[model samples]
Target chain A: MRKNYFHPKNLDGVYSVYQIEGLNQDRLIKNLKNGGLTLYNVKKIANHKMSLEISVKQDKNFFAIVEKMCYTNLELKPKIDKKRKKLLKKGVIATKSECGYNIKLTRVHGKAYPLYYLFTHVGVLIGAIIFCLGAYHVDDYIFSFEFTGSGNVVENRVVEYLNSVGVEKGKRFSEFDLNVLADGILAENPLLSYAGCLKRGNKMVIELVLAKNGTDILDESIKSLSSDVDGVVKELKVYRGTPLVGVGDKVSAGDLLVDGVISHKDVQIETNVLAKVVVLAEFNYTFISQFDDRETHAELLAIESLNLPVEYSKITKQPDKDGYLYTVTLYYNRVFVAG
Target chain B: MSFLESVKEIIGLEQFPAPVFRATIIGDVAGFFEGVVDVQTWSDEQIVIRLKKGGFIINGKNLYLKKYCAGDLVVCGKITSTQRI
Candidate 1:
């Protein structure tokens, strides 16, 4: 058995040790002696068929060496710490205890190149590049715009107006300031009662509430009309058009009371006349009731396959029809029937 | 590829075409061995199986065959060592 410190191939100053479990000691020792690693010490713990510890200097192909040793005892676990490379690079003695062995590397003034240190720096650089790519990447600019609550105004005209003011579809999200764009839209269009611009991911949602034009009452093209029910006109007030009926006059349904045209200075001017005509009427109403009660038919059939077994099932007959009829007079008046 | 093979791949059918002996150890408590030719030994302390290429011996405590169907077998226990010969 070699009792001296073993020098590992491809590594300087830094060394490693492994504690392998559930492996044959004689077979492992023989393999290690021929495996080209400078073996330092081999120790057996108290428990038989339990654990073995081996220490050696760092090797370039340490992982490959461990994998080669793994097949002998299929369950053999060699614990190694790749993080010690950072500490070793800083010239600090680092020790890590694992399941199979304890690794201790001494501090040295000279530089020791470790594969783990190179891999760590390279991994950090790659990670930083990936983060930068994610932060700057932009996908799918705004492709469509949708409008809601734009009534009275023509839809195509509203779409055209939006397109004219740079609020059209296919525009990028970064291209416009939302608040400023909404304010500009409202300023340019006086017909909108409320206007809003919203960016929902890649879609622009535009909400528009159109202002109601109350000038319909003064529009000349509107024709005047009378009371809808037979009643005495209690009050009458006309704002623009000519009135065809006066107060206290009896009018029936479909009677025209106001005309949407006024004659002034021998010329007829057409305008929508605003008026309020209230009519008071009195009447009585009645309702009728009807009902029926009856019953019919009951049958049953049994079925089975291979083994015929009769099953007894209970059949219950329930009432098929039930409801109500209500008749009431709203006002005290004689009911008249056409004979 | 044939139409059936393409459809199977698309639907993620991972069954091997031929029955080949394979064994997988999950930590030290359980192992699943498939395509087992024969079981040479079975007990609470050890289990020996014959595979296509060689034989494997599993030594443990409280070992038992959890399941066996066709050529597949599952053994579970507090396993200590596994050796191939």
Candidate 2:
């Protein structure tokens, strides 16, 4: 029961109508005035029943005061009259009866927490889980391997060689060190002048630049044929340049059998030396059978690596018995802490 | 004059000489009365009020005191009957 309970109808506010039964109009008026509340309107509908429109300021405080007056009337005795008076001064509703002064205030509404907060918290947790899973998928293992180069070499053969050298695709993206893989490829193959590997999205691209060998690319240049072994040249076919020595010529290793320079009208023209030579040689050799003395052994190797996504091991057969022991020593570097 | 009559005179001079005790029944739910000297006996179902003259008995279900100030008394419930004792 506060003076602010009733707002002007044209204004935006809340008001409550309470029926004060079993009480006289005078007494009711006096109690409300004492509680610091001005009754906006009081309509007597019966001899003992009246509709009271009290001015409400705060809903919680107003409702609590009303309820305390309604339900705790019997408890508002002389012993707690002082407390009751204090509550009344704060605009609490109290009425006197034969039993005692009791309070019966019914609450209709106030500041309550909305029910959607629980669902909102749960939704946020689920969203976070989904985000984490999506991040893991996007940054997961490498999807495929792509090889690019201009060479006469077979693509499958290069891919297999790269796999052997640990430049494999489908491995975890974080575990791959592109610089190290390129270095390893260049080291293993002397015919490749350039080798590089890079990641594009989920795909790993390997680039190779083959070194120009004489048998691959032929152009205008000076070259000489050298015998690979001690032999007698039975015949010769020169496709370019000049033929220095004819058939039945005996040539040793490192001897120039053809020349690539031609002189016409005192102008020397240099061209690539190209020729095909057949050689006949005689040799005596001794062969030994070591199938009975040789042994084949395989060892299952498993390793847990830190830098690698998953731990893996393979059973590699030793080239010789000593090779197995050497491979076991290399296993020490594979074990690392998992990310 | 008795002490109860003196209290009744002081608290309720406006309704004086009309009735030593006046009880007004509102349907069967509530009762408003004056000239209450003291609450002699009380319970959820029955309440006895010592008025300036004789006492009054209020009978009902869920009967509760709504307010009491000096000689003014308001009792609310499913008030069935009120009898002069």
Candidate 3:
């Protein structure tokens, strides 16, 4: 059997090349062999110098002997191939190299590249972030208003009504209900028949339509205004129907004051239109004078929608003292509402 | 084969006291051998290796120990001859 000192285990992991030029190089080789170090490619090129390959895994032991023996005339530079490099990374490794400087090359390169970019382009990155933030929130505010209509509309009233309903410039449009805003616009202006609010790309579009009169008369059936009470007409105003009785005309009950039938002089056809008229009749309203005076509906007349409007007031007899008569005129008009 | 040699082969026991030694020269490019006890003499031209059975002298040009592991060694050079001394 071969002795253990003659051939040791394979020392092929992470080796380096070294050249030694000193006196008694033979002694150095002898010391290396006796120290149980494996050597490869031991060549003698000069009389007192030789070069050899030794494993880097024995860095501390190999350098300890070299430094102790004052072998200062030697140079060692690690030459790594793929197989030896894998061994150094996985299993056998030297903590600090004696052949080179005490510096780590890979860690510095891995950490510095990112920090360099971050420190150099900080302003551009911040600007990009702010731009993205503004783009995300731009849809909340309203900027312009565009009004469109078929007829003439008061633009200022629509704008004012929208602002009063909390739909204004720079306000979040979603906070205000669109339906309420549209209804308020129609109510504030009596002239507008329809009001619709449309939101399109940060702009509010108001659509207005004026009321078309005389076009919505579904019942063109000939109608007339008849007096329900017997009195004298004090004031009379006609807006649509023809007036049959003028002011100071004595009218009795069941009398037609305005005629809906109209006969044209040039045309042969007779047209029937709805009668919209206002008549004020004189009435002697008498009330018992109590110690407490209370207002009554006898004086005030609203003239609301009624199928049968009062065209005259009848005075029966004069009351004695407490029943003294005073005149209360009432306004009666047939208003034709077209929505 | 002798009786002890064949028994040792069958039992997988290594030949003791005198290890086997053999040398192969491949077209003067390299030489390989095993069971070496020591590197006796080394220079640029020759290297004398001592084995258990005997010793060997290798003469060549630019001869170096390519590898030595577990008593197995390789020598590469332009070899003129190899002789057992």
Question: Which lDDT tens digits does candidate 1 get at residues A1-339?
Answer: 764333223345433434444434445444444454344323333322322222223333433454444322222123234443443345343222222433222311123434433433576667777877865443336777777776424344466567777766666777788787777666666667677878776777778777675222334445675555665666666776788878778877778777777999999987766666655542322212132211111111211111222222222333333332222211111111110
TM-score of 3: 0.32
Model 1 lDDT, residue A133, Cα: 81
- Ranked by TM-score, top first: 3, 1, 2
Q: Write the per-residue lDDT of candidate 3 for residues A1-339, one digit (tens) a residue.
A: 754432212222335556665556555655665566676777776765566666644544565666555443222222223553554456343323423212111111122334333333577667777888986577767888888996334576677667666777898777877788888888887777888888887888888887665243366565666777666665555544667887777777778877765657865443454444333433444444332222243343322222235564432333445544433444343322111
Candidate 2 lDDT by residue in tens digits, A242-332: 6766777776656667777777899988767766665543221221222332222211221222222222223323334333222221111
lDDT of 3 at A258: 72
Error of 1 at A164 (Å): 2.6
Error of 3 at A336 (Å): 53
Instruction: Arrange candidates, best DockQ first.
Output: 3, 2, 1
Q: Please, what is the whole-model Cα lDDT of each candidate in the order they appear?
A: 0.53, 0.55, 0.60
**Candidate 1 lDDT over residue span B1-85, tens digit each:** 9886787688777474643667889999888888765556555687787777788899998776664445666778888999886
Candidate 3 residue-pair clash tally:
0
**DockQ for candidate 3:** 0.22
* Cα RMSD, model 2: 24.1
